[model samples]
Target: MEKSWNNRAWFMVLPVLVLVAFSAVVPLMTVVNYSVQDTFGNNEFFWAGTEWFEELLASDRFWEAMGRNLVFSLVILAIEVPLGIFIALNMPRKGIGVSVCLVLMALPLLVPWNVVGTIWQVFGRVDIGLLGHTLEAIGIDYNYVSDPIDAWITVVLMDVWHWTSLVVLLCYAGLVSIPDAYYQAARIDGASRWAVFRYIQLPKMNRVLLIAVLLRFMDSFMIYTEPFVVTGGGPGNSTTFLSIDLVKMAVGQFDLGPAAAMSLVYFLIILLLSWVFYTVMTNRGVER
Candidate 1:
């Protein structure tokens, strides 16, 4: 028997399609137009071809920012993935403790980005801030404003604090979804704690770990607001990621052509890397 497919559902999706076209596609097209053309103040645009792209590709600033972004992403993934998994493993598996752990883990994720930045900014200050005052009392010179290393540390710590919970929540979800049969089998085998995690829990959590890694990578790479608010691209561009540099070019200097080119490159890099991550992780999941 042939089932009739409902063509009427197409109408339901048409509005969404139109909305996306207006919101995303049109803005993207405008960006593309600006990328390939030079603009003068009086609504005049000149055909510039790929000159801006070539310049951006050759610029040291672009490479420096890219390097910073890469380092930050790698460091974040290194710290967050393992930390999240460990936290997930230790979290209470049932009862009131589970509720308490879940709520605590969720609290940081609920804070707005700007507010997170402001909180950290105040928290890290040397005068009245608990962190700063404590550090100063302990004879540690901690100043994000004057020192590049301090700025980097603050930004990295802030990011970890803000986003690690997301990884924990995802990993926790994966952990909780595993069937009792796996644990029963492990118990019957006399599997040690490490053995249980290795042979049972790790494999079960692989898919969710992949998702957490990708989300964290993309978010860390594209991070702007919190870091910008906290450090303002900082003491000497030490923490200036690609998005920060792009905004500096576009808004700070009002250089549309180069900024557009940089933005396109940034978008392509993210898309390519995300595709690679998805492919590698999905394949590994299938193999497991």
Candidate 2:
């Protein structure tokens, strides 16, 4: 039997489509316009035809910033994913403790990005902040403002503290959805703790883990606010990731043509990398 198609459903989606076109597509088109053209004051644009792109691709600064971004994302995923899973695995499956644990895990995520950066910025100060003063009292020199290595450590640690809870919550949700029968069956078969986690728990959490990875990757790659507020891409540009560099080019230097070109390339790189991650994970799942 043939089912009748509901053509009227298109009407329901039209408003959303229109909104997206206005909000995203139009602005993207404006960027595209800026990327290929040169403009001076008085709104006059001249054809540059890939000149900006050529310059950006050849620049050492662009490549260095991109490298930093890649390293940061990789480090974030490495630390957050395993830590989140470990924390989730130990959390109470039920009872009053469950709510308490969940709330504590969620607190960091509720803070605004700028506020988190501010908190860390003040917290890491060597003068009066507890962490800084304590480290100084212990005879360890710590300052994010002057030392490049210290600046990097502070930024990385700040990110971990702020975002790891997201991974924990996602993993916890995945774990809670597993039926008790799985655990009961594993026990009946005398499965060891390692066996249960390796065969049952890990497999069940695979989908959420994938989501967590992609989200963390994209967020870390495009990170701006927190690091900007903390380091302002300083300490000899040691922590200036691509996003910061792009902002510097666009807003600080007012180099629209080059900045637009960089932004498009940045967007493409993110899209390609994310696609690769998705493909690899899905294929591995299929194989298993």
> Which candidate number would show the highest TM-score if scored against the true structure?
1
Report the lDDT tens digits of candidate 2 across residue range 130-229: 8888999999999898988888888999999999999999999989999999999999999999999999999889888998999999999999999899
9 Cα displacement, candidate 1 (Å) = 10
Instruction: Tell me the tens digit of each residue's lDDT in model 1 across 143-187.
Output: 988889999889989988999999999999999999999899889
Global lDDT of each candidate: 0.92, 0.93
Best by lDDT: 2
TM-score of each: 0.93, 0.91
How much is the lDDT of residue 202 in candidate 2? Answer: 93
TM-score, structure 2 vs. true: 0.91
Query: Model 1: how far is 186 from its true place, Å?
Result: 2.6
